[model samples]
Target: MKKLALNYVDTFKGLSKEVWWLALITLINRAGTMVIPFLSIYLNKNLGFTKEQVGTVMVCFGLGSLVGSWLGGILTDKIGYYKVMVGSLVLTGILFFGLQFLETYTQFCLGIFIVMTVGDIFRPAVFTALNAYSKEENKTRSLTLIRLAINLGFSVGPAVGGTIIVAFSYTGLFWVDAITCIVAGILLLKVLHPKKAKVLDTHENKKGKSVLTDIPYLMFFGCMVMFSFIFVQLMSTLPLFYEEYYHLPENVIGFILMTNGALIFIFEMPLVKYFENKKIQHLNSVIIGVLLTALGFAVLLYTASMYASILIGMVLLTFGEMVGFPFSNAFAVKRAKRGNFGAYMGLYSMAFSIAHIGGHKFGLESIKAYGFLQTWQFMAIIGAITVVFLFFLKRIIQKEK
Candidate 1:
């Protein structure tokens, strides 16, 4: 037990102080992430919108995210991540506050679209900042550390958000989210300002291959889109499934989802460290992650014990996320070594944005048309197809090497 504790502590060694600061800011920002997880439920139960209407609103959110990510990449390269992160976070906070005022279906659809457009701009800029802040050898661990903060915050957020919803109202979530964003931006501005911290500029001036024209990357991008499409159902439709299908309460559902974040917080870093030390291929780890994610959903198909299945299924998905996301991020950073991280990570984020548009719509529509069982099956099949694509991507990477 002592050895195990020491091993976990060792993962924190060799990281730059700046990376730790970055992770701290991420923890604060993500800790207030109370809105998105419960957005669909709020629309359905409180606002009395149909699932179809909620789907439309979410698609709009994805459209805005797509625009935000593309614009963020360009701006981060042209200006710098410092300005982009500050502006995006502060503006997004204000927008979150404004969103509570929107009522009608059309109003919500348009409002959420604009808010997400501004909000998601933070995604690419933050990624670029990660590249600047960490050393080359420590990049994957740095990314994992950031993810650890995010999951830790997530573990806290939904559980707290559930209590807020119960004690106050949905409006309370916006206030907390808004305040956190503003605070995070201000803290970032004070601590990570370019004047104080050393941000690398070599990648900024270097011309790299256009992501649009990169063939292998384009293939990987498609696989990510599919992967995200399957993964996002956890946010969009899964809550609805818990509510309508299983008849679980909001707090119980929140705790169930919280289990994913908590488990990742406890296990992901050690797992990534193990994989890294073993020198496993990034593609191989990602393939395993994808397969496990498929299995996570498949577990739900067993209807014997509701409590047991939900816990087990969430455990599978959390492990899959733990393995998949960090390596995939490192892979993108490695490819961008020749060029600009802003552009590469921007396009990488855009894949999730695209999935956002399609995934929410697909999941909601599938649930509406067929049923939850069929939807889970479709998600599993998509994950399997994505694993095949990743194998081809592996070959392409090897050939390039």
Candidate 2:
């Protein structure tokens, strides 16, 4: 036990201060991630938006995310990760406060879109910085640490947001989210060093290979889009399901949301270490994780009477999240050639962005057409399809190589 404890400490110790700070930045920023989970609820309940209208709004957010993801890559490589991070943090924080004032559908939709566009650009930069700061051997674990920090913050955010919603209402949610984002920006400014920042994104360093040209990566990217479509439903439809179908209160919903982060917070790092020591293939880990995610949603099929089923589903879902992303990030990092890492990471981030449109927009439409239970069932079907697609993606890489 002592030996294992020592080894774990040593593993964490292997990361540089920049990596550590980046994890802190992630924790701080994500801790305030109260807005998106509740955005659908607010739009529907408070703003009197129809589900179809809400879907349209999400489509706007997705369009912004698409622009952000694609632009984030080109910019990160062109300028530097640190500058991108700083700008993303401060500007997006200001936007959050702006959201509270918007009432019209047009204003809210445009606001949501702009917020997503500016805010998400930091994502690729964060990944790029992680790669820049860590030892090559410790890279995947570094990814895990940052994700762990994100979950830790998420555990705090929604749970607290739930309470704030009760005590002060949705206004409280907006203020709290905005303040933390700005604070995170300031902290990031103070901590990161001048020179150690910014990996040169010049074409020479990138070897002039575009991710668009890499067909194998494009296959993996396609599979990622499908995977994200299923996975993103947690943020999209699940909360609404809790309120409408389950008739749970906002705080109760918050607690359930907290469960995702709490599970990952407790189990993800140790699990990452376990899998790393086992020397598992990254692709296998993703496949297993995706199946577990599907199984969790399938467990939702038992929501016939038991509210406890949601809890059960979240466990499987959160664990699947834990197993999937760190490995998937590693797979992405491995595929990048030199300087194009930001671009690669951007494309990877775009998977989720695109899924927001496909998952949330299309999903709301599905719920309208088919109903919630059937919609969830279809998500599971999509998950299974994605798994098959990934297997094909793996074979494509093998054949191409």
Candidate 3:
């Protein structure tokens, strides 16, 4: 056990201090991200929103994410990632506080859209920042390290969020989320001053360098959208399924969701290290990861025992996340070296935005129209198709190699 512990610690060695600082800031920010996972329940139970209304609002959320990601990439390239990251964190914090006040359906839609646009602007800029902070050889581990922080925070957020909702109300989540965002922004600003931080100059001066024309990158982007389309149900419809279908309470659901983060925190770095040492192809890892994700979804098809099915499904999904996300990040970072890093990561982040915009709506409507069983089956099918998509992208990447 001691030997295993030492080996796990070794995975974190050699990363720059700034990378750790970035991970710290991300941890603080993500720790307060209690709203999104519970948003569907809040809208339905708290505000008495219909399923279709919730779907529309989620679409608005996705649209905002798409806009924010695009803007973040542009601004990061033009002005440097430092300005974008700090501004996004602080502004998003303020937005979350005000979000709870918007009561009507239309108001909620606009509020969520604006808030997500501001909040998600942090994504691409942070990816670019991490790239600038870490050494090349340790990049994947660095990515995994940040993901660990995120998952750790996510693990706490849902559990605490569930308790907060039960103790106070949904409004309490907004207050905590708002405060955390501002604190993270301030903490980052104080520690990583622009004058002292390693802010790389964007290559805007170089003409004709654009991600729009890159076919391979675009293909990768499509694959990510599909992957996210399947994965994002955790936030959108899955919680509702827990509440309505399995009849679990909020705290239980929160605990179940928290398991994803806890598992990733305990295991992702070592697993990423093993894969890196093996020199496994990034896309090949992604293929295996996607397959696990599909299997996770399929586990829900087991109707014998509800608790067993949900717990097993969560474990499979968490392992799939542990495997897939870091390598996808590394692949994007490597590909970005061929062009503008901000643009590449921005588009990469936007793939999630595109998925967020459509995925939630699709899942919700599927549930409304079909049923949870059919929806899960369809998502599993999408996951399989995404694996096929990743295989094609692997071919393109090899040709480039």
Tell me, by TM-score, which candidate is best. 1
What's model 1's lDDT at 339?
64
* Whole-model lDDT per candidate: 0.87, 0.84, 0.87
**Decoy 3 TM-score against native:** 0.88
Over 1-401, each residue of candidate 2 has an lDDT whose tens digit, in order, gives 89877765665666677778889889989988688767889999999999888878978988998989888988888898889999999988899988999998999889998998998899998888887777676788899999888767866776788889999999988988899899899988888856545433223353757888887788888878888888888986898888888899999998898888777765777788788889998888988889899888899889675666898899988888889888999999888754377898999999988887777767777888998899889988988998898888778777866
Question: Can you give the lDDT of residue 271 in candidate 2?
Answer: 85
Better of 1 and 2 by TM-score: 1
Worst lDDT run of 10 residues, candidate 3, spans 199-208
In model 2, where do residues sit more than 4 Å from their true spots? 1-13, 37-55, 100-103, 162-176, 196-204, 239-257, 302-312
Write one digit per residue (lDDT tens) for candidate 3, span 282-371: 888888888899999999989799999999998988888888878988988888877777788899999888887788779988999999
Q: Report the error of model 3 at residue 115, Å.
A: 1.5
For model 2, give the 10-residue run with minimal summed lDDT.
197-206
Segments in model 1 whose C-alpha atoms lie over 4 Å from true places = 38-52, 162-173, 200-205, 239-255, 302-311
Candidate 1 residue lDDT tens string, 220-329: 88888888889989886888999999999999997897787778777888898899899998889989899999999999898789988888888888888889888888
lDDT of 3: 0.87
Q: What local lDDT score does residue 74 receive in model 3, on the 0 to 100 scale?
A: 85
The residue-level lDDT of candidate 3 at 354 comes to 88
Give residue 70's error in model 2 in angstroms.
1.3
